[model samples]
Target: MDTTVANTGTEGKTWGGGNQPLKSSYGKMMMWFFIVSDALTFSGFLAAYGFSRFKFIGSWPIADEVFTHVPFFHGNYPMIYVAFMTFVLIMSSVTMVLAVDAGHHMKKTKVTWYMFLTIIGGLIFVGSQAWEWGTFIKGEYGAVQTNGGNILQFGKYETVDGNAVFKRVAVSDIAIDAHGERVEHERKNGLWFVDESALPAYTVDEVYNGLKANSDVLVRTQIINDEGEKTVLSREESLNQIKNNGKLVVQGANLQVNEYGTSLFADFFFFITGFHGFHVFSGVVINIIIFFNVILGTYERRGSYEMVEKVGLYWHFVDLVWVFVFTFFYLV
Candidate 1:
């Protein structure tokens, strides 16, 4: 008996494998799947961050205080630079959509230019994020790490128009070096070939002496009160705390210690933002690849610009993720 595959009348129908589900190409459908899975992953990360922040609500670092730096300007402008980065990323997404539209119209020149601008915007955003991370790691106003692993900041309460304004005092401004030669332990000089990290800008003794010299400045605890501000101690309490409890001068943030209130804040900030930045960088690279293809007339030869559309989906997803990150990390 001879047997051969025969298409019945229903062969051209949905159940007969002739239908394209969701009217999407195989590549586009796969891209959507990946985006969905990745979105869930990011959601989980943000959820974990939210739970962690809630757990340490009182000691959590204020986003406004922490991310208050621009590229060249050196004043306290809270969330301004982050807002700029967000704008750049969103504009890049807009350009990406325009490129996709140009591809649909088979406008090779327009696609090339738009894709180029998208790539540039992504690069600028990535560079801005890198600078922000560098500034975060190299903290502004140094704080003291207590023996119990608490971060104690220095600020003075001033009355302006009958209202109290807290003025932050930098450790560098107030710290005076006493007569001592403090040497960092280096690998070359240590026993067992051990290596040691670089020393901080000032020693704890110097900070204590500075606090003693400045009667106006007081120690601020990480604990937040009902008013959502760090608890400020009295002058005598500040002196006693620094003199007895202060152990190290923490100048910046790291995996080990953060000058900011809680180390958890720094951990989540670095992890979530770094993950999002990596996605942006990856999208930039893919855009570059597609951009060269557009210049080479690859999609034109194929008679379809679905490649641009696929990558456009990815770029939009990245931009959307960033909006959520900005909301959770900066605004909230």
Candidate 2:
């Protein structure tokens, strides 16, 4: 006996798997669903960042001061490299769009070239972000952390272009470390498994003495004033704070201490940006896979270029997410 079920009234209806409700293929629709879910995830993270930044509005690290390094030429070019990275990512999205358009026209040569450009753009962006991470980890000017966990940056007030600007004073320029023979705490020497990070380049005493010796260099407190800038203390106040309240010398950014400002700022920076960077890197890998397949004429032989369109959706979503990330982290 054959046990074949008869087709119900919904056999040819949208309820069956045969219908394209949104005028898209099953794969494209699923990609859209994934993109929507991922977007919500990013929104949650950025929302948390917004709330934290709002709570600590005053002492937040200034983006201009924080992202002031270029690859080779470095002279306080604030936001230049970051802007370039943004531009590159946006351009990659543009190239992806071109590739999708070419795929629609069945112009394989055009698709190949545009996809190649997109891959190049992605590589450049990922490399630039890695360089930025390195620069941020290896801080430019060292700072002294107060007993209250405040970051004290040394700078001098200089008149430039008819306005007074805060010029950062390098620790090496101002601090003279007389004490030598500093050793890093290790597990072998102490707890048999516990280990500590290397000591800072300068001791608190050295920074204090440097503050006292330099009359021009003043301490810029983390607190922001009504003028929308960090409150630069008077010379006398600067010396007094470092002499009495200075606890440890912080060199770069980490989970424990941040030479730039609050430790929470660095924590969020690392977590959020690192997550986004991972996404970008993943997209690049996927693009490379798809790129190779295109060269092999996989989609061409299948009589459909829908794979390019599907990946383009993901690439565009990634680029859109970066725009919001840029606004929150750098512009805002």
Candidate 3:
């Protein structure tokens, strides 16, 4: 006996075997699934970062001191460029909303213009992020790694507005190069198969000597005191620390060493921000494809602008993720 159920006009029912579920297209449902999964992934990454930072809360790099850079400017302007990038990305989301609204109205020209603006905003944000990565890796104020893997920075206390402010002193500004013959250890020249890393700008001895010569500059340890400022050593202690505990001259940030505090901070920064940057770049490419499709009247011929709405969903998700990332990494 065959047990087949007959269709009784259940195509538009809630549990009916239809393409649209919950009044949403299959494409939109899939997009929502992807966004939810991606959000979980980001949450896991951020949670891991939070735990690690808590483990090393006192030694973690300060965001303001680390990101005090602006394009083509020399002065220390904390969070200026990052703020600009966030604003641009948020505005792009606004433009995406306008594009989706225009698509609903079947206004192809308005949709095209809005999409174009969104693409431009994404490009600018991506470019700015790349520059920020470069600046982060290059580093600003150089430091020395101690024997116990602690970072020892050179700085001085200055009175600004009746408050004491710590000013960073670059290693190059203090250390006098000894003109020593430093050579890269190539695989061919060395006995081991692996090659060593490049030499730093100054030697430990040069840094020590420079520290001794500079009386005003003091040594700032990685430890944060009760007042939330890095513990600064006196002149005698500074000279003794450089003479006895200094291990190597560290310049920039990498997988191994970080001039700005712990290497773990740099690791998370690169991984999380790089992942978000990749998303932004992919969104930009997808928007370009959709923009051309709009110009060619693809959605217009289909009598629906749902494609624009779908892409807008993705763009808005990307923007929202960046907001969380910015808060976690920069503000918090």
Candidate 4:
């Protein structure tokens, strides 16, 4: 054992390889340690995420129904768009692995080309993430209720005869704080600076009153149906009950959302997904820097390109995080 150790030292000195500490370099070792800790950190996050999911298992909304918009299609398509996003990210992971394989063989040309492709893949994935975020923020179906608070879910029913199929209003539709004025937003004299559409449909005061009167309707971030068509119910009856002859007031960013789905749902969905998307963006930036270094022969001049390996590790770890995210956020 002593002779083997002595021989290793002698060989290292002969090769002027002192920089390669313990058969590796300071940077590579540090990167490995960082990766280990980061892996644990990511694991903790995923664990917490899973716990939250389980805690809210019954109330948790289905991801597919929530984000079902395609690139060019209308609001009817389900999460097919997001599924494409997952595929893009997974494909980028493959490209990154190939780039690392080229690096292992010291094939500089192949490494550069593969790395370039990997960067492109990462960029594309990030772009797709951005589009998804936009769709989520914009929102989709408008919610029921004049207060615009709470989601109204629907359930299917069969007539007692067993031959008739029908859908009833899932929840009461009472829009709260809807955009524009309940009364006309026109000037006292009838001249208007802004169009009537620009005004809020309902004021906050009216929304509060409506919510107080309704007891059967509940609110939520996303509304779904068990088997029948989920119709947006009107708060007309509830409003009429509360004020005898009062007109229902409703309108903007209220409890109701436009395209992506429910407004609150858009809020949480965008927040979580955007944060993850940012990580991918940063990873791509780092990859670009490493790609340039590989192109300029910086490592070749130094006699060792361990930096490439270090960055490769980071890339793979990013890919690893996405694996669990994809499963939980989409498939599950």
Candidate 5:
């Protein structure tokens, strides 16, 4: 018996093992693959964040309260700077679109300009994120960590529009340093291989004394009450807590402590945002490389600006990821 094979009519078609499968080049297809994988990674991160947040929803740091800072401006402007960063990042995506369009049209000058604008926007966003991180780590108002690891903030309730609102009071404002000759423990000073962290600005005794001196100040626990506000303790309760349960004064956020609320919140904030920031920074660097190539007539000689379009895909993915992050991390 003899067997013979016949060619089907689908030869050279999209599914016929063509070089450009589904009308996409190999490079473009690879970029899409990378994007999909990266997207799944981000989804996993955000999902984990959501789960952790749900688990600690009551003691979670309020985004508005935590992100209430604007560069070169002083006041309680919640989400203002973050909103600005989002806007800049989105506008950079728009510029990337324009750059890709210009590349398709073979307009090198337009592509160059748009790519430059996109780079500038990325730089601005990265810088703003750095500033925000600095502010978060520095912490505005400090709090006391109870022996139970609960964070207790200080504030006073003020009437606004006939409604009571709690205003944050800085630990520096109320805490008076009374301890003398306090020093950080070094390896040489104590254990030969162990070292203690930096000393807090004020001791618990000093904080207790200061709270006693200030009649209006009250302690605010991280637990949210029925009215969707942090549970504020009465003066007597506040003093009792500081005098008995206060373990240490937390002035900022770190891997170990967070003045805003739980240390887990700070951990997630640093990890997720830092990961996203790394993506943005990488995109910026890649765009800079592609921008120089565009100026050098690299794509023009090839008669196709597919390179720009590929990088644009990555840039757009970064921007889109940030939208979800901003929503889940800030607005939600």
Candidate 6:
């Protein structure tokens, strides 16, 4: 039965042979409607993120610093790896479309090969996302402090060599327990797990002393020059001399984040990106099923590979969502 009809004598009509305006099998049409609604949901999230950016006014975490890491390297190179991952995802969408085209022509072998490529692309994307999450959860350069406990960033120097210097300070430079060890929960007794390796650098005494030496450093969350590059505050200006001066000592969750940075950003970043990644994963599974069905000649006997085309719609939509996620979450 030729279910497709061209220019039938009926106006404003699309039956199954002629789709009746917006009619298709319940599954296919419903998929489109569902996707449209979900897109709006994601847009809401992105918009809320933008609102937060405006609310912060002067202080906010710099995206470049937060998301920087080389794919495989000794030195901390950043951004290039995740950018490559974006390309990988877009290319996978292209492959999935090609598979759909092949299925339309009943070319079973072509469909199988392209579907395989699509699946591999999805796997690589998931791995890259995991790497990105790991890097974000861990911060860099540390922070500046005031007598009252407020933090300041060292973005460029008021006077370069006066007291502002970017050096790897140690946690011992900051705080030391009475036992001469930095205090933290015992990993063995922790309920789930904790990253002890990510312990802070520098001791309180070292930070205060460093602050005392640098008189010009300001104790705000982050520093912004005309160009907006973020710089860490000098040790002497921030911690050494600044204790007893009024500073915002944000702790726990609040301490975790602020206009300069926040733990909430990290937590939400991992959760949202992780959920979208899981969707790509499931899409790959559906692709594999379609791939084997083609190879096994199920479609050849069934006379149409519409199933492949259906799943292709889903795979491509997943790629589309990632594009938005990347732009809003990383770039902007």
- CA RMSD of each candidate after superposition: 5.8, 5.7, 5.5, 8.4, 6.2, 6.4
In terms of TM-score, how similar is model 6 to the real structure? 0.72
Which of the two, 5 or 6, has more TM-score? 5
How high is the lDDT of residue 248 in model 2? 92
Candidate 6 per-residue lDDT over residues 118-201, each given as its tens digit = 999999998888776655444444554455334454333443558844333322233333344565556776845764543334
Candidate 4 matches the true fold with a TM-score of 0.64
Candidate 3, residues 140-253, lDDT tens digits: the string is 889999998889999998999999888889999999778856778888888778888778888889999898888899999988899877899999999999899999899888
Model 1, 184-286: lDDT tens digits are: 8886777858867888878888999899999899999999889998899999999999999999899889878899878888888899999999999999999
TM for every model, in the order presented, reads 0.92, 0.92, 0.92, 0.64, 0.92, 0.72
What C-alpha lDDT do the candidate models reach, one value each? 0.88, 0.85, 0.88, 0.57, 0.89, 0.62
Worst 10 residues of 5 by lDDT: 1-10
Off by over 4 Å in 5: 1-18, 188-192
lDDT of 2 by residue, 1-332 (tens): 01111222334456453456665665677899999999999999999988888998988988888988888895878888889999999999999999988888778888899999998998899899889889888888989999999999999989999998889988878887786656788888788888887788888888888888888999999998998889999988999899989999888888899999998888888888888888889998999898898899887886667788889999999899989988888888
- If both were scored by lDDT, which would come out higher, candidate 1 or candidate 5? 5
What is the Cα-based TM-score of model 5? 0.92
**Number of the top-ranking candidate, with lDDT as the measure:** 5
Model 2: which residue pairs collide? none
